[model samples]
Target: MTFEFEDRKHENTQLPNNLSAPNPGHTHQLISIMNTQKRDRFELLSAYLDGEVTATERRQVEEWLDKDVETQRLYSRLLNLRSNFQSLPVPSAQPVEQTIGQVFGKIDKRRRHRSVAWGGAAIAAMVVAALSSVVPGRQVWQMANVNNSAASEPLYVALNTPVVEIPDTVLAPAHKSAPAQPAKLHQQNN
Candidate 1:
């Protein structure tokens, strides 16, 4: 395969031999498995640079770097890449406390909005329920109960039929409530 180099410095350097095997004439192959794939070589060298390899693997990599110019060149390029990444400017970040406070503030606001919405809904329901009984034809629940009772009676009412305890107030008309009595609180020592 043909080799291409973009940089003039790496012009005479070896090609990217990502093959499964190295040169048959190479002495390194006799020492260890130097005939590893190109990806394996890259990973091995990278791990070596990171100091993540075992003692045997480290020794092997060191030998490769010492004997082979290609390996040395690859290692040098990796080092340069790492240094370049390190030299890059890090973007400014929001403080932890500020971020957390903002999040909590949002949560509290949402909770307050939800509680207000629920309270409003409850008030609306109470208003509707109170008005329904007072307004003519708006007593939906009472009418529904009457229809349900007639349907459940089954043709005729017999003495043997189960008696349903209906409240006297239900049959009576609505009446005005008396004034509220002040609550009398009695405190006892525990």
Candidate 2:
């Protein structure tokens, strides 16, 4: 049975003409190769549209576009896309001087705010120091008065002393060597 099957297979393999039939595997391989080449051409055309291709590359892409209608269509689509982008409006650029001035102005404003904050802190510290000194001094004075009645009494006597009125003739000479005239004193009671 194996010998008969081999004989039939050999007979079926022979064709009437010298031409060979196309293999399905080979056809699939060729299709894949063509697809790869088309992809490469599309990439080349994209680069040409972007102005990234060299002169030699430009000529190659042009030649490919001329040879293949599909490549030519792709190139036209990319050109249209580029033109659309170029037609869009763009914002105007600011002058360098104006931009720098604005940046400096913001920096100066921030610095002023920081300085004001520091000034407020300094004022608060000064108030605290003044209060601290005055409170301690008053406490010490009160303590001294409580400990010594004689010392405290003298302080009151000095404050309540009567004002004495002296005549202008007593202060007439500006020079120390000049003779001084004696002036009568009048005491005013408080």
Error of 2 at 74 (Å): 5.6
- What lDDT does the true structure give each of the candidates? 0.70, 0.69
- Can you tell me which runs of candidate 2 are displaced by over 4 Å? 1-43, 50-77, 123-190
Model 2 CA lDDT for position 13: 35
Residue pairs with backbone atoms closer than 3 Å in model 1 (clashes) = none
Q: How do all models score by TM-score?
A: 0.33, 0.35
Tell me, by TM-score, which candidate is best: 2
Model 1 poorest 10 in a row by lDDT: 1-10
